[model samples]
Target: MKKRIYKDIKIRKLFKRYEIRRRLLLGLINDLSIPLEKRMEFVSQLNRLPRNASKVRTLNRCVLTGRSKSVYRFCKVSRLALRDLGSQGLIPGLSKKSW
Candidate 1:
């Protein structure tokens, strides 16, 4: 059925998005030097049940820099930026909630 096929496609996309988020969040937490437990908590809070394109773009901007040529480029930028922020202790805590 066409509807079943569409549903399957949607589910696959959702799984892929979750995989991306997991990878990105793990990288972020590692760069920030947060404990694994805390990282998991942050990821749980940040994860969206349904991905939104606008939200993803906004998060990408926050985590990365440089012109968006491709996903690999973005990943590089994000890793570098995260290291810089970590070294500077710029990563915020709960009290500074408004980012």
Candidate 2:
């Protein structure tokens, strides 16, 4: 789990470093007014970027337990963690569901 989190952190950093440049290249590549040669150049530039720099490489992980599945993006934790926190009243505005 720690390994997964560390890998995610590295991917996030790489994505941050290349996000703007990648988006620009992609946008340029897709523009119909751009010359074919220029678009190919943009494609080459996009391919030259590190694979991990792509946003798709980033995975949602639980901040407290490092679980990867069922993570709540807004809370940055997994489902179980969210439940535990809500039940303990640690999360403001979140309450445990009771019958």
Candidate 3:
């Protein structure tokens, strides 16, 4: 639990640090106006970035329970946690469903 959260934090930090560089490199690489040689340099720079820094490697984790699955993007909590909070009337506009 804590281990997953810690690792998530570390990855998030790395992503934040390298995100701009990655975007810039990708933009340059995709620009047709740029010479192929220059674009190849950008591609190489993109490949040199840390694996965890890539957006695809980032985990969508529940902010409260640290669960990595079934997390609500807007709420940032797992479905289980969301149910619990909603039942307790903690989440605005959320209520128990009825037949």
Candidate 4:
């Protein structure tokens, strides 16, 4: 688990460092006003960036237990923790529904 967290942190740091440049390159690549040659250059630069810098490489982890599976994006918590909190009425506007 710690190894997973460390890997995620490393990826996140790389992503942060390259995020602005990546966005700029992507924008340049997609801009129709730019010359095709310039756009191709930008595409090559983007491709040269480390693959771990991509957002797709980041994994969501639970806030409470650091579990990677069944995470709730809105709350940043694992499903198990969310369910427990909901059952305890600790989270407002969230409740367990009964059929």
Clashing pairs for model 4 are: none
Question: Residue by residue across 1-99, what tens digits does model 3's lDDT show?
Answer: 999999989998999999999998888898999999989988888888999998888899999899999999998999999999998899999978961
User: Cα miss at 53, model 4 (Å)?
Assistant: 0.7
| lDDT per residue (tens digit) for residues 56-92 in model 2 | 8899999999999999889899999988888888999
lDDT of each: 0.51, 0.91, 0.91, 0.91
Which of 2 and 4 is ahead in TM-score? 2
Give the TM-score of each candidate.
Answer: 0.31, 0.91, 0.91, 0.80
Cα lDDT of model 4 by residue, 13-83, tens digit: 99999999999999889999999998999999999999999999999998777899999899999988998
True-structure RMSD, every candidate:
18.5, 1.4, 1.5, 2.3
Clashing pairs in 2: none
In the predicted model 1, the residue pairs found to clash are none
lDDT of 3 at 87: 88
**Where does model 3 exceed 4 Å of error?**
none
Worst 10 residues of 3 by lDDT: 90-99
How far off is residue 17 in model 2, in Å?
0.3
